[model samples]
Target chain A: MNAIGVDVGGTKIAAAVVSPEGEILNEVRYPTQAIPPNRLVRTIADTITEAKGDFEVGGACVAAPGFVSSAENKVIFAPNLHEIEDIRLDRELGSATGLRITVENDANAAAWGEFRFGAGREFDHQVFITLGTGVGGGVITHGVLLRGAQGAGGELGHVTIDPDGPRCGCGNHGCLEALASGTAIGRRAREVANERPRSALGRLAIDRQVLGEDVTRLASEGDEAALQVLDETGRWLGIGLAGFVNVFNPEVVAVGGGAARAGEFILEPARREVHLRARSPSRDLVRIKEATLGPASGVLGAAALARGEDGEYVLGPSKRVT
Target chain B: MNAIGVDVGGTKIAAAVVSPEGEILNEVRYPTQAIPPNRLVRTIADTITEAKGDFEVGGACVAAPGFVSSAENKVIFAPNLHEIEDIRLDRELGSATGLRITVENDANAAAWGEFRFGAGREFDHQVFITLGTGVGGGVITHGVLLRGAQGAGGELGHVTIDPDGPRCGCGNHGCLEALASGTAIGRRAREVANERPRSALGRLAIDRQVLGEDVTRLASEGDEAALQVLDETGRWLGIGLAGFVNVFNPEVVAVGGGAARAGEFILEPARREVHLRARSPSRDLVRIKEATLGPASGVLGAAALARGEDGEYVLGPSKRVT
Candidate 1:
């Protein structure tokens, strides 16, 4: 059945009318507003309605950032989006558009997208990691989403890498997110550039502000300092991946997000460290690869949720739709 | 249905006739042999026959140590038990005992036992950790065992904790098993006792070889060095538990095995460390408790497998019985 999928981000909201086989029939994007919660709900509803047009839709799903409650169909908390505490996205949007809607975490949605239509399509068990500003991931085991009892699982980024390392956004110390994320890479680059002015990264920092992308570019150019930074961050990613490999024993680990765009510079070192640290059986079989869906995963996963085919997290029909 | 359950360990084999509600009707134990594999199979079958006596049984299960092939109903590998590679336990035991049989991993069996009749009975999602010689665990998520694509998931103890610390038996360095297991605890205790000869643990070390149990006894008697040893090992366990909490987000983490008999000496310090390292939301909800089933978890879990009421790891019907 055809359904609409909405990806609600901090800066923008993207919606797509997805066919039964997961092809996007139509799409729309709108700038997200820092408005009251009710208005934001309307904005999401308006976007989904516009994307639907005259096509008969079976259902819809909105992929929202932060903790989406599988039980309540609400946004429990979104740190990036202020004043949206426990917003009932499914109920409000379903009422506004006169159609049922399912709500899921953005990372989970992306993972579902990959599992169903992208890199993880061939594997029944996979760990999908998105290394953007901060690390985010989703776990699919036996082709089912692992939403914890409180719908707060798959928080791979917050797992500790070093007990005595830097502080993390989750108020913990030395989370994988604090060491291996794009933000972490940029921070390390700036620190190294400031420490050694004679290095290529330092020269770039002196010439202008250096970012994670600039470090990747310099590393590709064979700059020792830039390459060192990538190696260090990649090693941390590998160390954390080893723990996940041991715990979940997934068939493949798909790396996505902005930092993953560094390509082999990050993955090569990660593969080395993973081989060095991970145990047998799992380490021997697991393949670490780049994610394939790119920007479309979140929306497509939401659409899959809308169709009630999104793994094991059952989203019952909305009473408001009736 | 009533079933016969067997637990095969490196040193001994234990068999029991279990009632429908998991009660032990009769039990027997036999020393495991290092002879040819076929002789060992007969020993297991004889013990089960003796345990069953006149009681009628529907099916039987043998929880073998090492990797169990859920599809083949065979022991893939048992490192401690030589020449048993790919031995079809179900075929031999079923034919000898005249009953259908299922084969399962020992750790998986223990976890199923806990999930069905022990500490995990109240929680649908639980992580069962047995801190014995090496740390062994099983994962039950959403009331189903999380058997990975290769039936090798839930290798929790092998997860890397200190990337540069001691080498593990699995050939990895600084795994949780290398840091927090009973063997690790004993090794640490012996090292400490040797270093500080004036302390209580040191005196015991000078008199005789120190064991993990000696450290526990001394710690209970208020020995500073022994207490410190327990605290150190317990803290490492806490650190690993934090990572598991973030990864699985299970409702409860039940700590079992021989070392767990130390009671609050290990648990109190572990609780403190877990609270310190674990992140919010999930950290607040998870409960770390001691396992309740003791040595019976293995046999009981095997019974669960024989009844075909265990988690998602599907065991095919016995060929001999058919």
Candidate 2:
């Protein structure tokens, strides 16, 4: 049976009707700016209803950004999309689309997407980390999603790598998110750019605000200043990842999201750090690589997570699906 | 049916015949200091044979310290015990004791003990940390022990908390083991003693080396310097635990071993740090408490891990057994 996966993000809403093989049968998208605050829920429901078309969909899952309570099927907090927070998304969407629905953290959905169809398709254990505006993560161990008590497990970005280094949005000091996220990259780029005023990154900073994309682009252009910034970001990312390698012992660490576009620039340093920090066998066995599905992973993963009226995964666990 | 468990440590060889309900039907112990290097394997077999008595034992497991390969059933590296490394303990001991044997990391076995019969008895998700000469840990998520690829997973103590703070035994800087272990407590106690020369801890340091237990004893006696050392130790421990809380999202983090004897002195501050660093719902729900099982956890947990001819837990997973 086909299932619908809706990715409700801060910028846009993406919905796709996906087959059990992870193929996108039909897809639809709407910019978040086009929908009114009160219309958000209805818009999401309409998007899913449209995406399914005549695919004989059994269920759907909405991947939202924030603290999601998977057991309750509700979003506890979504600083970016407050319209869905504290609401019974499953019930609301179920009534609107006539399909059973579940909500999940977008990162978790993306991770599952990679696990099922992309980088982690071959491994039983995986750690998927997305470096976007914020660092978000999801973990799978022993073929099951590691949703901890209350379904809040796998908050990987908030771990402290340097206790006194920097203040984070979560009100903690030196969280991995504060040091490795796109926001962190931009912040570090500015600092490095100022120190090296003759570099491409430094000249770009003088003209306008240097964003994470600018840093990646400048690094790709061989700017020493920007290279140093991304390199440091990779170092910080690896510091956090070394802990994961030691803790989860995953076979693949799929680095995704907007910043992962930096590719080997960030991954190379992270791998080196993991080699230095994580113990043998675990560190030696793990492969830190880029996530393959890109933005569509959200829909692919959410659809895979969708459960039917029979109460089993519509798409099934990938390990057993084949 | 009962199962045999062997705890081969640097100090002693403790073996037990444990019932399916976690009861010790028979037990025996021999000091490692008494055995010659060549006789170590034979002595372990003798201990298992002596401990079983009249019990109908199924399978057995040996909980050893250091890096273990559960799949290979061999100890790769054990700083404290070199005699057993790289040997086929299952084959060697099975031939002698006539029971199928498996090898596991000691900390992992203790964690399973705590999860099955101690503080984490009620929870499916648990993080068990032992604060001894060095910090070691094991995790249970979704009722399965997290042994990473090649079985080196759950090396919790080696996670780097501060990149440049202190060099660890694994050659990393600012590892949780370097900061929060009994060795770390002793090291910090010495440093604090020098800074507060008029305090009780300082006065004691003048007479001899201030050990981790001495700090705990002085703190219990209301010494400010000793209290500061434990409080600081707790703070560092909490920083590391906060990461575990976020990463594992466990219901309870059971703290065991020598330094945990300080109890609330270390726990209270560690809890405070977790509250400050960890996210909501997870931080709110987790209970960080002293592990109830003590030294017996090693033998008890290894016994529980013993597999039958059916390849199932001799005692079964606690959640299923009930």
Candidate 3:
């Protein structure tokens, strides 16, 4: 079977034709313009049209960066894309593309992709964390995605490591995202560099503003300040993961996103903390690994959603005509 | 239909004949001996026999401690009851009692009891926490119990709150149970008394050993030392609950434990911490309430398990009984 998966990001929209095994056959990308919801729907439809020229689309699924309600096609809330709030993406896209469309939270779609075709392929219960500009997470329990009562479950990044540490974008204090996210890492790196002018990171920051990658690069190069920041962030991430392990007792945890690219520098310490803190039996069974799908996970997972299959993106007959 | 519910605890076994609507028609109790697993099964059968004279018992369910298997009747591991490890509770009890039987973890049963007939009746997604010598928890998502891949998913107490604080029986450090359980609170009170002789708690402890209840009583009386211990424990509990809120995003959190008898003194602080820590959308929807089923929750929950109704302990019917 085949499917079309659309990944809606802040700046661009990418659509791809995916096989049942999650192989991408054809792809199309376009800049996401700051237009009304109706126009945005047309652009997404056009992208799907472009991808359909080479491969038959069975079903279409869209991964939106926000609270996508499963019971309805509406985007309840997308902080980065505020204008799309409550827009019926599924209905609009289905009308434009002339195919059935399903919408899901981007993180959940990515997690579904990983569970079916990436790092979590072998596990029945898994958690996928994407450590990008802000942290996002998806949970699959007993091989079923957990959408909660209001399609608002699996918000792992908001689990607090310190109740009094810092204010978070979600109006919480000391959330894991506020401490360990790529955005958090960069913010801390910049603040520390300014505070400690003699440090190596400070000298590097003289040329450009510090980014999450720069901090990871500096930590790898043996910068004490940078390493300390990464270590602290890893500890907090471990704390959060430990809590998840206790609650879900998942078989595996797949770490994705730009920050996870640091590999052991972040994952090693995080695993150590999880071992030191998580309960036995369940903790012993959990394995931490990097996500395998890379950037394509969202689209593939969304495609699975459209197909209504048990795993990452399901394809249907309607999409085949595309 | 009427069903038999048996709550197997460390000291006593409580059985009840429950109506479909959750009303108890009659009940019986027996002391639980440290006997072999088969004998324990026999004891459960005898209790059911005693209760059968009063009501039309259609099915029987036993709620045991430790990790229940996917089959519900099989006990994967019961560290507290070593002899029961790997025992097929349903088959043994059903054969002996001449009735259909089901088995489940005690916490899951209790949570189900609460969800179907007690405090959580109004919510589709709920979390139940029972605090005693240890912390036990159960999760219900969209009205279904989440018995992860191993049926050992809801180990809420095992989540880490302090990475370096204390060693838990589960071989992890700084677990919520190690820091917030009744045993942990009492232990801390004793340690404080020993270290600070002039403190009020120290004076109270000069006469004899301290109990969790005594510490709670002292804290309620404005004893500063006792208050600190409870406050600290409450904070840790809140931190763990915050993680739960993020993952489950349940509409209700029902707390039932000996420690919860402290009421608002403990619950208010825990709620404050969870509210300050969990993400916005989930935090706004969550309501923390004390468990309302009291001592009967276990047996009632177990009964719900037997009926194979909508609760945590979901069990399959025995072919022989049918």
Q: Relative to the unseen true structure, what is the C-alpha lDDT of residue A74 in candidate 1, on a scale of 0 to 100?
A: 86
For model 3, state the Cα shift of residue A87 in Å.
Answer: 1.9
Q: Which residue runs does candidate 3 get wrong by more than 4 Å?
A: A33-38, A53-58, A187-207, A215-232, A307-313, A316-322, B33-38, B53-55, B166-171, B187-210, B215-233, B307-322
lDDT of 2 at A275: 92
The candidate 2 chain B region of ten consecutive residues with least summed lDDT is B313-322
Model 3 DockQ reads 0.44
lDDT of 3: 0.80
Where model 1 places Cα greater than 4 Å from the true spot, the runs are: A34-38, A307-322, B34-38, B307-322
Scored by lDDT, the top model is: 2
lDDT of 3 by residue, B1-322 (tens): 7888888878887888888788888998988764556576677778888886756767888888888774656777776566567777767777787777777888988998898888888778888998789898998876667776667778888876666768887777777888888889899999988887777898989999999999889888888888878887787788878888887878899999898887776788898888777765787899888999987889888887785434323333211100
Provide the lowest-lDDT 10-residue window in model 2 chain A. Answer: A313-322
Q: Write the per-residue lDDT of candidate 1 for residues B1-322, one digit (tens) a residue.
A: 5777789898888998887677898999988754455577778888999998998877788888777776578888887765456877677777888877787889988998888778887777788999999999998877767767666778889887777778998888888899888999999999998888888999998888888899999998999999989999988899888888877778889999999988788888888877887766778889898999999999988877784435222222211100
Residues A116-215 of candidate 3: C-alpha lDDT, one tens digit per residue: 7789877778899999988999988766687776788888888766657778887777788888899998988888888876788999889898899998
Clashes of each: 0, 0, 13
Q: Spell out the clash pairs found in candidate 1.
A: none
TM-score for candidate 2 (chain B): 0.97
Q: How would you order the candidates by DockQ, starting with the best?
A: 2, 1, 3
Summarize candidate 2's per-residue lDDT along B130-183 as a digit string, tens digits.
999989999998777888766778889989999998889988899999999999
TM-score (C-alpha) between model 3 and the true structure: 0.87
DockQ winner, 1 or 3: 1
How high is the lDDT of residue A17 in model 3?
88
Give per-model TM-scores.
0.93, 0.96, 0.87
